[model samples]
Target: MDHQEMADVESQNLETPPDVFLKGKHQVTLKFDDVVYKIKTKKGGLLAKKRETVVKEILKGVTGVVEPGEMLAMLGPSGSGKTTLLTALGGRLGGKLHGSITYNGEAFSNDMKRNTGFVTQDDVLYPHLTVLETLVFTALLRLPKSVTKEKKVEHAKGVIDQLGLTMCKDSIVGSPYLRGVSGGERKRVSIAQELLINPSLLFLDEPTSGLDSTTAQRIVSTLWELACGGRTVVMTIHQPSSRLYYMFHKVLLLSEGNTLYFGKGSEAIEYFSNFGYAPSLAMNPSDFLLDLANGIYTDEFNADHTIDKQKLISVCKVNCVAQSKPALKGIYDSGKDQNRLQEKDSEKWPTNWGQQFLVLLRRDVKERRHESFSVLRVCQVLVVALISGLLWYKSDISHLQDQIGLLFFISGFWGFFPLFQAIFTFPQELTMLQKERSSGMYRLSSYFMSRVVADLPMELVLPTIFLFITYWMAGLKANVVNFMYTLLSLLLNVLTAQGLGLALGACVMDQKAATTLASVIMLCFLLAGGFYVQHVPNFIAWIKYISISYYTYQLFIGSQYSYGETYPCLTGQCSIVEFPSIKQIGVHFGLHDQLMAALGLLIMLIVYRLIAYIALMRIGVTKN
Candidate 1:
C-alpha cells in the first residue's frame, strides 16, 4: 500500500453492525521508538565471598510500529528477547526500561489499559469450569454495568462462535491432570476471553507454542482476521511454517536483543537476499530467518567467512531507518484522528462491589463444588463418624470419662481436618488470582470475601453430618438443648480452624510449606488442648488460650455438665462436677466460662481471616 492510502486507512473508522462483537470500539495504533530494557542480576556463585550486581541488557534499541488493522509477528529463537520486547510494548513490563511507547501518539494511561488485552503464553484458566461458563463469568466481571446480564451472556456466546469453539463450549478447560479441551481449543478459548472486552490493541505471547502446524495456522488465521477487523494485533512467535509466515502483515526479527529485520513478511526473503545471506535450498522463510539469527549458515553461503552475523545486523539497521521513516511519517500525519479515539476511563472497574462479590461467589462455588462434594470427602466423614460412634456407644453418667474422651476426639479431629484442607486453597489458585487481579477484574476485598463466603456451605455441611450421626449414636446428651449447644461449638470450631488454614495459605503461598506449617501448628494446639496435658507450665500455659482445640473441648464439657448433673459413684455418692475430667475442663465456672469459650472461638474466626485478607492485600496485583 502507498503512504497516502495507508494514512487514509489509519484515519477512517471501520464501522460494524450493532450486533457485531467489535462494534463501536476504538482502534489503536501502537508505536515504539528505540526501546531498550535492562535488568540487574547477581553475578557470583554460592561460595563466592561477595556477589556483585550486574546490569544485563534484555532488549537493545528495538523499534517498530504496528498500525491499526495489521498483525505484527515478532520472530526469534529462544531467549532472543521476543517475550521481553512484547511485554515492554504491552506496558506490562517492570524494571528499568528506556524507550518511548505510545498508543495513537499518546502516552500509556488507564484508558489505554482498558482498551488493551494481553494473553500470556500459559493459559490461566480454571480447570473445572466449562468453556462457556468461563467466558460467561469473565464477561460478567469485565463488561460494563450498562450492559444487561442477558446481553453479556449473548456476547459471550457470540465470541465462542466467532472463535469456532462451538464444538467444545461445554467442555471443561482442563489441566494436565484432567482431560478437557485440546491445546488448540484451549488457546482459542484464551483468545476469546480477551476478545470479550472488544479491546482495540491485543498482545499475545506465543499463542501457538505447543500446537501442531495446522493448529498454529488456524490460530494465526484468527489473529489475522482480528487485525483485519481494525484491531492492532502483536504476538511473539518462535517459528512458523511457510503458510503461517505469510499470514502476518509485518514481521520483526530479533537476535541477541538487536533487530535484524523489521518490515513486510512477504518481502523478508528478498530483503535478506540483498545482503548475500539467502538460503540455497527451498525452505520455510521462518526457518531460514532463524538460522541466520542464530549464526547458522549453509556450506554454499560460507565461502566468505568475513561476512558474518554482525554484517547482516549492520545492513538491516541502515535499511530499517530508510524504510521505517516513511511509514512513521504516515502514522504521525494521522495523529489528529488517533487523539480523538481516547476513551473515558473514569470507572476503575466495570462492575460494582455487590456485583463483583456475587459473580465471584458464584464462580468459586462452581469451581470448588466437585472437590468439596467428592466421594472421597463424603466417605471420609461417614467413616469417621461411624467409627467414633461405635467406639463410644451409649455412654451415660457411669461412662463420663469415655464421653469426655469422645469430646476431645471431636476437637482434635475437626481441628486438624479443616486446617489441612484450607491450607491448600490460596496456594492452588494464586496464579489465576494474580492473572485476574492484574487485569483489574475486581477488588481484592470482593475476591477474598467471596472466597470465604463460598466455603461456608461446603465447609460446614460435612461437620454437621458427622456431628448428627455421632451425637445420636454415642448418646452424649438426650436433651435437644445440650445437643444443639454441642453442635454449635463444633461448627464454630470448624470455621475457626479453616480460618487458620487460610491465613497460613495466603501468608506462605506455597502448598508444601503451608501444609507442613499447618501440621506443626495443629499438633501444638492439640497437645495444649487441656485434655492431653492439664497443667502446662506458665511459660506454655498461654498455648491453651490460643488453641482452638482447647476452647472447643472446654465448650463441649461445659455444655453437657453446666446444668449441674450428678454421676453414679462406684463406692459412694459423688457429683459429676467433682470428677477430675469435669473439674479440669472448668465446669465449675458454669455459663460464664461457656460464654467465654464461645467468644474466644468467635474472635479467632474473625482474626485469622482478617490476617488472611491483609496478607492477600499485601501481595498486590502487579505481576512483575
Candidate 2:
C-alpha cells in the first residue's frame, strides 16, 4: 500500500511523533515520556484531510508538573497538533498513551479525570438555560456539601464575574430554534462550568478558536485571571495575536509532532533563531514560530527553525527528535497497587448513587422543557388524527375491506407524524449530550433514560390528544372491544414511531442525512410492513419482520369491531353496523389482537432500544 493508505490503516499511531510512537506499554501515563504525537488521520482518502501532525514521541524527561498559578500556552500553525496535545494532556487521546502523568504525584487515570476539567472548542450548553442558570446547575453538582445552595449561587455569580460575563448573566444561551447567549458568552459558560469544581488544573482545546479577535482576547484574559488565582491552565492556540501571546507564562511549540520550543513565551524567539535561524530580529512571535514549526508558507522560510517555512519544518523534524528522559528516580520499588487507593475502582459502589443520579436527572428534566417549536409537533399529531378519523368515519360494514385498507393508513399516519418530529429535533439533543458526556459530567445511560422518560410524557400526551379528539369527531363504533383495541393501537403506534426514530438516529450522524435516512427507512418498512399488498416470495417476507409498519398495520386493522357491530358516524347515515357478532371482523372470543400488538410493540421497543444503545455506546467511546 502507498504511504497514505498505510496512513489510513494505522492513522491513529501515524500522526504521533516518532518519539511518542516509541513509548512501550509499561511507560504509559498521561505524562509524556518517550511518547511522540502527530496530527494523523485514520484513513479518509485525501491527503489534504490529514491536516497536520503533533508530537512524534512524548519526550519522557519533561516534568509533568503544571504548577498552579502558571499558564502553558500551546502555540503553532493550524496543523501543529496544538489541540491534540491538549486532549492528550487530559488523557482523552485516541490510542495507547506513553509515560507517566502524575496529578500531585498521584498517577493520573480515569479516577483523576473526575477532578480534571476540560473545555472543548464548541460551547456545549443547553440553549435553554441562561448564563447564570447553567453555571449554577453545574456548580450544584460539582461542589461539596460544605457549600450551601446560597454559596453555589454565589459561586456561579463569581465565575461569571471572573469570566467577564456579568453583563450577559441572565441572557438565554442558544439559538432561534430555541433562544440563548452569544457564542463567546457560551464558551465562557463552558469554561465557568469546568471551573466550578475548582480543579487545580484546567485544559482547553482551542479555547479562542473561531472567536472574533476581541472575544479571543477576552477569553485569554479570563484564562490569565484563573492562572493568576493559582489554577494551572494549559490551552492550544493557532496564531494568538501579539497581545494574547504576551498573556502566556510558558509556551510549547510543536511541528510534525516534534517540539520546537518549550519554556517561557518571551523566550520563544531567542530559543529558535538563537539556536541559529535568524541572525537577530523581531517579528510577530506567534507567526515566526508557526512559519518555523509548521510549513505555514510553502515557498518561504524553507528549513528547520529557519526563515523559510517548509524547510524550517523539515529541519525541525530532523533535529528536534524528542530527547529520551531518564527512568523514574524516586520510589522505584513501589508496586502499581500502591498508586491506587482502592483494589479495583469499579469493585466499590459509589457511596451515594442516588445523589449522582439526581444531579444528572435534573439536567435532563430541565432540558426537555417545552420550547415554542413543541407547538409545531402538537399541531401535527392533532391534524393527522382528527383529519384521518373524519375521513374514515363510522362507515358501512359492506365496505369492510375498504375501511380495513384505510385502517393501515391511519396507523401509518399516527406513527409517521411523530417520527417526523423526532427525526428533526432529537438529533440536536444528541449533540448536546455528546458534549456533556465528553466532559465526564454524566453517563450515557443517565441521559438516555431521562430522554426516554421525558419523551414518554410527550409521546403519550400528544397521541392521547389526537386519539380522543379524532375518535369522538369521527364517531367510530363504541364497545369495550373497540375501546380497548383503539387504546392499545394508539400506544403501540407511539412506541413504534419512537423506536424507529431512535434507530435512525443511531445509524446516521448528520442531521440532514439522518432525516433523509429516516424517511427512507420509514418508507421501506411501511411498504413491506405487512400483507397489505400481495406477499412476494420468501425473500421479501424477511422485510416484513424488519417492517415497523406491518405490526402497526396488522394491529390497527385487527383492533376493533372485529366480529360485527352497528355503528353510526353519529353525524350521518354514513355509518355501518354489521349485526352484533364476534367472528367476522377478525375478533375471536377471548382473543385479543390488541394484546398481540402490545407484545409486538414491546419487542420493537426493546430491540430498537438495544440497537440504539449499542450504536450510542460506540459513539460514546469513539469520536472523529
Candidate 3:
C-alpha cells in the first residue's frame, strides 16, 4: 500500500498520550520561502602564497512547505544539495542563509529550534552506553524539569517500543572498536535517541544509507508511523527500493540546488512522464527520478543521438514549475494563524552547570572504567617498569653514572606514560563531544572538567604502581623522607605530562597528528633534561624551562643526594663529591631548592591545562 493509506492505518494504531501531556504540544506546519544558502571556503595548500575564498552555493530559491503529518523525502544524486537543504531547514546549517523559515505561520525562534530534532548522517553515540542508558541520559538532559524522572523513563520506553528496539534495549551501542548491535539496530537506536525528546519536527539525513533493503524498509516504516502520529518529518534519502519509496507521503527532487519536483510521491512519476521521462513498470520510481535528476535518459528522450544535460535540466525545471505552481501557491499563500503564542527564548542547556558536571562525570566514569582496568594496559606498564628496574639493578652511589642513569629513566618513564595516555582524550571522542555539545546538553567547560576529574584517579593508579616497583628496585633514595618526596614529585610530574598531552590533543584534533607531535616534543624535552646533556648552547637552552622531565630529574637528583658527602673513588683515593646536589649538577640546570622544582612542576600542570581549555573552547563544536 502507498504511504497515504499506510499513514491512515498507522494513525489509528498509534497510542496517544494523555491530555495533560498534550496540553501545550501540537503539530506545526514547516515552510521555507525563497531560501538561499552558500558557504565561503578558503582554497590553498600550505605552501601557497595566498589563499582565495570562494562562495559555494548549496541551495537556491528553494520554496516548499511540509504540512503536519506528512513524511517528505528529499531525493537527489550525489552533490545535489539534499543534505544542505535539510540542514538549512533544521536551522543547523552554518552559512550565509537568505530566507524566512516559519513554523505554524510564525517565524522560527529558539523555542522552535529547541523543540526540533536533527539526526546527523553519522551515529555519534557512546559505544559503552547501553541503549536504555543512552536514552535515559538524553531524556534527563533534554526533557523539561517539569517531567518527573519516572515519566521520562516511561516516555523513553515508549519510544524504544515504537522504534522496535525492545529486544536490544539493554545492549551496548557499540562502534568500530567494539561489536554490539547490527547496522539497522544502531540506526534505530539513533532515531530512538532523538525520539526521546518527542520533537514536533524530526529531520534525518541518509538514515538508510548502509542498511539492507528489509532493514531500510523497517526504518522508513517507523518514520511513517511517527508522521502518522501528527509530527512533521523530512529526510534526505538516496536510491530507495520501490516499497520504501512509496512509504514517503511527499517527494522533493533536487538537481544542482534547484527544485525539480515537489508533490505527492505517487504523482512524482506522472509529473515526470509529462517531460517524456517515463519509468518502466519494473523500474524503481526512486531510481528513475534520480537518473533523471542526474541527466540520465534513454535514446527515445534524446532522439538526436546527443544529450545536453543542462538543456534537459532546464526543460524539466520549466515543466515542473508549470505543473506544480498551483499546489505550491496554495500551500504558501495560506493565511497566518491569529492565535500563535509568544515564544520564549529557551536556554540551550536545561540543567544547571553543577548538575551537568555531575551527570557527565558519572557517565564518563561508567564509559571508561573498563579501559582503566584493561589487563593488557596494566601488564604493559608493569612489564616495562620491571625491565627498567632489572636493567638498573640497584646501583651504588660510588657508580655515579648508573645512579644518574636511573634518575633519568624515572623521569622519562613518568613523562612519556602520562603524555601518551592523555593524547587520545579529545581526538577519540571529538565526534561524540561535538554532537552532544550541539544538542546543548552541557557547556564545553563541564565536559572538559568532568573528563579531568574522571581521569585523575585512574591516571594516578599505574604511575604509583610503576614507581613502587622501580623506586626500591633501582635504589635511588633509601631514606623515608627522601622516598616520600620523590613519590610526590613523580606524581606531580605525571599530572604535568598529562596536561601537555591534553593541550596537544585539543590543538590538533587528529590522533595520529597529536601522537606524532607528542613524540617530537617528548624527545626534545628528554634531550634538554640535564642528565642527557650536561651542557648545551644558549640558543636552544630554553627547552629546559618547558620540559617537565628537566624539573622532575632535578628534583629527584636533589632528593637523593642532599645528605651525601664525599665518597671513595675507584682510583683508591677519596674524592670530594656532592653526589645529589642540584648546585653541583651544572649552573645552567641547577635548582637552589627541591621545593622550587616541585612548585615549577605544579605551575606547568596548571599552565598546560589552561592552554587545553582555551584550545578546546576555540575548537568549539564540530560543524558537519
Candidate 4:
C-alpha cells in the first residue's frame, strides 16, 4: 500500500463507528444462536444442574445496518437479557457461547481490547487521584506508543469536556469512605478514563442505572454527543423515562433472550403496534417497551400482558432461524470450541508476546501506584514504629522477652496485611478490571506483575524504616546485627504476606468470605508464632513451619538474646546488666538454621502466587 493509501486506511479505522462495525465492503450482521447459561454452585458443582438456565435456549439475531456514527440504545426490562446480549457482543458473556459474533470482519480477541472500551456500572477510581491522573493512567495503559504524551493529555481533556466534566476536572473522585465528586460525576470520570484511547466502539451497561432522573439524562446526552463525534456507542439501558427515550438514534429491543426489534426508535413503536400494542400518548416509551418485553404489567400501556410472550415467540422464530441446535448440550461437557480460532491463521495477529507483556507490565505498574491503600499502609507503619519506639525510649531491658513477642507480632501482623487488602480490594476492583479485561485492555500477567512491582518499593521502604525506628528506640541491638536481621525479617514478611493476599483474593469471590478466611489463617499463624503459647504441639506443630511469623520471631529472639544485651528476662522487671544471664546460643550457621525455618513460609508464598495466577487465568481476571 502507498503512503496516502495507508493514511486513508488509518483514517477509516480511526473513523469507524463504535456501533457500525466496518465488515469489508458492505456486509454486516449481528447474529446470536442458542446463547444458553446454566448456574453452578460455589464449588464448581452444578446446583441448578442444567435446569434453571440463567438464560433459556433462546436465539436472537439483529441484522440492521447501523451507520458509522450513531447511538444504539438497547432498552428492556431487568431480566429481559439486554445486558446479557450486550455482554455477548462485547465478547464477555458467560455460559455456552454457540453463536458467532464478528466485528469489522474479524472475531473479537484479547488483542482488540486496545481498540474497544467498556464502561461498567461500577466506577473503579482511585480515591486519592484527581480526574486527570486517572484518565491519563488509563490512556497510558491502553494507547499505542505512537500516540504522544501531549496527544494523550489532549485526548483526556477532550473526553472530559465531551462528558461535561470540566468543573470537577481537578477534583478527587469519591469512593465508599472518601468524599469527593458526586455519583454522576464519578460515572463520567469512569467514562473519561476509557475515552482516552478514543475507542472505535464503546459499550456501556446501565450508564444511567443508579443516578437520578436528571443525572441519567445528562449522561445519556453526553453519550449522544460522543455519537455525534462519529463514535459508535451501544449501551444497555433498563427502563428509561419518557424524556430520555428520544436520545437513541437506534434501538435494539430484546425480551427473554429474543430480539423483538432492532432498528430505529421510530420504527420500534410501529413494530410493537404490529403485534397489537400501540404507544399511548401519556405512556413512557421505555415502560411500553419493557411491558411488552416482560409479558406482564401492561394495564397502563395496553392492558395486554399476552402481547409480550406472543411477540417474543414470534420474533425468536423469525430472527433465530437456527436449523440446527448447538452441537453440545451442557456447558460443562462443551469444552471450549477453540477450533473456530484456527481459521484466523490468515489474520495478521501481533505475535510479539514479549512486547505485549512489557506493555501490560508498565500499565499495571501505573495502576498500582494509584492505589492509595498501600500509601496509607506505609504511613501507618511508619507512625506505629515512631510512636512505639519513642515511647519505649531506651528504657531498661526488663521487658526484653515481651519485646521479642511484640517484634514477632509486628512481623506476622504486617505480613497478613496484603492478604486482607487484596481480598477486600481486589474483589471490589474486579468490577472494573473485569470490564477492562473483557474489552482487551491488558493481560492478566500484566496486571498481576504491575501490582506486585508497584507495591515492592513501598513494601520494602516502609518495613525497613519501621524496623530501624523500633530497633533503635527499643534499644535492642545497635550494630549491623540489628540492621541486617530486622531488614531480612521484614522482607520475608512482606513477600510471604503479599503472596497469601493474591491467593485469597483469587480464591474467594466474596470479599467478606476472603476476609474471614484470612483472619482465621492469621490467628493460627499468630499462635504458631511462639509468642503467647510456649511451643507448637506435634499435631499443630507443622503450622509453625508454614507460618511466616514463626520464622521472623525465632530469628529476632535468638539474635536479640545476646551476651551484651540488657533487658528483663521473662518477668519484664530487670535492668539491662541486672538480668541473670543474657547469652547468644547460635553461631553464624545456627542463625542460618533459625532463618531456614521460614523457608516453608516462602515456599507457601510461591505456591499461593502460582495458585492465584492459575485461578485468575482459568476464570479470567474478572469476577467469577
Residue range 1-624, candidate 1, lDDT tens digits: 432233235334332222333667877888888889999999899999999999999898888899878889999999899999988888877789998787888887767776789899999999999999999999999898999999999999999999999999999999999999999999999999999999889999999999998899899888887888888999999988877777778899999999999988877877877767676767788998898888876647545233377887787778885677676667777778663465565788888999999999999999999899999999999999999999988987688888899999998999988898899888888878887877778888899899999988868899999999999899888889988988999999999999999999999988898988988989999888877876678898888789998899888887687555777787665877778766665655467778888999999999999999888877655531
- Model 2, span 211-272: residue lDDT tens: 89999988887787766665668888888887677677777777655566666666556555
Q: Give residue 75's lDDT in candidate 2 (0 to 100).
A: 76
- Which is superior by TM-score, 2 or 4? 2
Cα lDDT for residue 558, candidate 2: 58
Candidate lDDT scores, in order, read: 0.85, 0.62, 0.78, 0.64
Q: Any runs in candidate 2 off by more than 4 Å, and if so which?
A: 1-31, 38-65, 144-154, 176-179, 276-283, 295-361, 371-373, 393-398, 423-431, 479-481, 510-517, 528-531, 534-539, 542-546, 564-589, 622-624
Clashing pairs in 4: 18-201, 18-232, 19-232, 113-440, 397-567, 397-568, 398-568, 419-501, 566-576
Best prediction by lDDT: 1
Error of 2 at 281 (Å): 6.2
Residue 258, model 4: lDDT of 66
**Which residue runs does candidate 3 get wrong by more than 4 Å?**
1-23, 40-54, 105-108, 299-342, 563-566, 570-592, 620-624
Candidate 1 weakest lDDT stretch, 10 residues: 12-21
Candidate 1 global CA lDDT score: 0.85
User: Clashes in model 1: which pairs?
Assistant: none
| Highest TM-score against the true fold, candidate | 1
Whole-model lDDT for model 4 versus the true structure? Answer: 0.64
